[model samples]
Target: MNITVFCSAYSLDDRYSAPAAEFARLLGTGGHTLVWGGSNAGLMGLLADQVKAAGGKLVGIQVELLKHKTYPGADELVLTRDLAERKAQLLARADAIVVLVGGLGTLDEITEVLELKKHGLHDKPVVLLDTEGFYTGMRVQLERMDAEGFLPRPLDQLIAFAETPAEVFTHLTTA
Candidate 1:
């Protein structure tokens, strides 16, 4: 599987890092390639390191502006002219999408992906690893949207929330 992961480009506490590492390990050992932002910073860097150490392939879709932060060890790297193009390439290459703890940028990536999915632009499975209930608020808001008919499809069909790294894969495999 070509698993595209959207995550923070800033360092985070162990509470967040640990689960992300575990997820990367699993993705690597399962013989999947990681398709992500090509940054060698913070959580994104850590994910690439763990995945590579576990024998996974890395394909980075990087924006030209952040080229300075590009991962040095990626097996393949693609440079895009802008963020919008980067996001499009990421989705185009992914068999599934996994979102981990992130900041506004990460949120933006997931939101756009969901919006595209809702419009039937893609059917790739999207999973959020809700570490430490990090996504509780977002999940609640999405549930409300589902309840209010704000979404065109059922919430479950659009996204799956997992509490652990293992659960993330379970959702993907069963999706």
Candidate 2:
């Protein structure tokens, strides 16, 4: 499977990094490919390394403006004119989506994907790997939206939540 990972562009604490590496290793060993933001820093770099070490393919998508900041590990590197194009490419290429701890950019990626799914643009599985209760608030907010009738579908149908990497696979398979 081609798993597009939405993650932080900056390095995070070991709490996030360790699990991310392990997740990458699992993806590699499981014969899954990684599609991600094209950069050689932070959790992105760590993941690239782990996947590569385990013989997995890395496909990176980056915008031209950030060309200088890209990493060297991608087996395939695709450049986009801008962020929107980059995101479109990411969404188009992914078989499944895994969202990990990140800031605004990551949130943007996951939200747009969810909205697209809600609109029937795609039916790919979207899983949240929320290590250490990181996404508890997001889960609550989603429930609130469902309660208020803002959600077009049940929260479970829109997004799968997993507190651990192992659970992420289960959600993915069953999503």
Candidate 3:
């Protein structure tokens, strides 16, 4: 399967990178493909390296403005006209989506994907890797949304949550 991973573009803590590396290793060895942002920094770079080390395919979607940050070893690099185009490609190509700890951009990706799924635009499984309880606040907010009747369907139908790599992969395979 082609798993699109949305993770931190920049991170100073090894807490996040360690699991990301392990997840990548499992992804590669398990015969899954990885699609991500094209950057050699933070969790993105760490995960990409592990995937290559394990001999898995890596597809990078990069925007023209961020060309300077592109990672060199991706199996294939796709250049996009802008961020919107890059995001479109990422969503269009993935069989499932895994979100790791990240900042604002990651949140944007998650919300957009969830919105897409909520609207029945896609049935792809979306899992959030709640590494270190990073998504605690967001989870609470989602629950609130559901309770308030703001969602068209149950939150569980729109997204899945995994606290470990094992759970993430399991959800992907069974999704």
Candidate 4:
């Protein structure tokens, strides 16, 4: 499987980094390719390193503005004109999507993907690794949307949440 992961490009504490690392190792050992932002910074860098170390392939979708931060070890790299193009490429290359702890950029990526899924643009499974309740607020908000009939489809059908690295795969395999 080609798994697209949206995550922080900034360094994070152990609480966040540890889970991301575990997930990366799992992705690698499972023989899945990682499709992600091409940054060689922070959590993104760590993920690529661990995945490569565990024998997984890396495919980076990078924007020209951040070209200097591109991961040198990626097995394949594609440059995009902008963030929008990068996001489109990320989704285009993935069989499934996993989100790790991140900031605004990560949030933007996942939301765009979800919005597309909501419109039935794609049927790929989207799972959020809700590490340390990082996504509790987002979950509550989405649930409210579902409960209030603001969503056209059930929230659960749009995305799934996993508490552990292994659980993420379980959702993927069963998706």
Candidate 5:
């Protein structure tokens, strides 16, 4: 299945590069095509680079407004007029969504996935990869929403978690 993975594009900072590359390698090896933000910043470029190195098919979506002069993570670039168009195209192409550790942009990407699933626009699985327990707090926060009745108990199933790269692949296969 085509996997649309959302991640931060902050820069090639060591703090984010290693983890992102780890999963990118595994996802590619697992035979899941990768689609992500087309940027050479932060973990975005690193992940795409690793996937390409592993002989995986990668499809990157770029927006005219967000063009970085040089895209860091794209091989097959699909340029759109704006961010909104790019997001729509990405969501349309992907079978599932995997989120790596990232900031606001990453969060926003998967939020669209959640909203889409909530509205019955799609029924694809969404994964929150919790490498090194990075997403523990966030998971707890989601649980709080369930407890407060803002989120349906079963809606929590929309988001799945994984610890290592192997686990992420396992979920993709079993999903």
Candidate 6:
């Protein structure tokens, strides 16, 4: 599968770096390609670097304005006009989506894409790489939604959760 990894463009912690790199390695070994934000810093940069080092075929997308400030040396950096265009391209081009740790930007990207899918704008697999239970609140809200009948039971099925990169690799492969 051509997987678009929607991760926090900010950075990653040591706890996550090893597993993230491992996941990239495993994905390449399994003959899958990767897509991500193009940067040479932050978690996005680390993943792209490690993926390439591990022989993964990874592509990058970046908005032009942020390119200079964010992307120092991206292998396949594709500079676009704005965030909206960049996201639209990602949604249209990739088959599956996975998100790692992130802040507001990451939250916005993932949730917007999910909402789009929810409204029938897209049909694809979305996975949440919930390393160390980072997304506990979201999961709780999902349950709450289900309980309140605000979200369909099947909507909860729209996302997959794994606690580790190894588990994420396995789940994506076996899925």
Best candidate (score: lDDT): 1
Collision pairs in model 5: 11-42, 39-72, 40-72
**Comparing 1 and 2 by lDDT, which wins?**
1
lDDT of 2 at 35: 95
lDDT per residue (tens digit) for residues 56-146 in model 3: 8899998999889899999899999997888889999899999999999888988998998899999889999998899999999999999
Using all chains and alpha carbons, the TM-scores for the candidates as numbered come to 0.99, 0.97, 0.97, 0.99, 0.89, 0.89
Instruction: Please give me the total number of clashing residue pairs in predicted model 3.
Output: 0
Model 1, position 88, has a per-residue lDDT of 96
| Pairs that clash in candidate 2 | none
Query: What does the lDDT come to for candidate 6?
Result: 0.75
CA shift of 147, model 2, Å: 1.8
Query: What is the clash count for each candidate, in the order shown?
Result: 0, 0, 0, 0, 3, 0
lDDT: worst 10-residue window of model 4: 149-158
CA lDDT of each prediction against the hidden true structure: 0.98, 0.90, 0.90, 0.97, 0.78, 0.75
Backbone clash tally (model 5): 3
Winner of 3 and 4 under lDDT:
4
Report RMSD (Å) for each prediction in the order shown: 0.4, 0.9, 0.9, 0.4, 2.0, 1.9
Give the per-residue lDDT of model 1 (tens digit) for 1-175: 9999999999999999999999999999999999999999999999999999999999999999999999999999999999999999999999999999999999999999999999999999999999999999999999999999999999999999999999999999999
What's the lDDT for residue 60 in model 1?
99
Which tens-of-lDDT digit does each residue in 1-175 have in candidate 4? 9999999999999999999999999999999999999899999999999999999999999999999999999999999999999999999999999999999999999999999999999999999999999999999999999999999989999999999999999999999
lDDT of 6 by residue, 1-175 (tens): 8788887666667777767777778767766767887766778877777777676777778889787755454446677899998888777768788888878878888988877876778777788888777889987887677678775436545677878777776666665
Candidate 5's TM-score: 0.89
lDDT of 2 by residue, 79-108 (tens): 999999999999988999999999899989
| Model 2: CA > 4 A from native | none
Better of 2 and 5 by TM-score: 2
Q: List runs of model 1 lying over 4 Å from the truth.
A: none
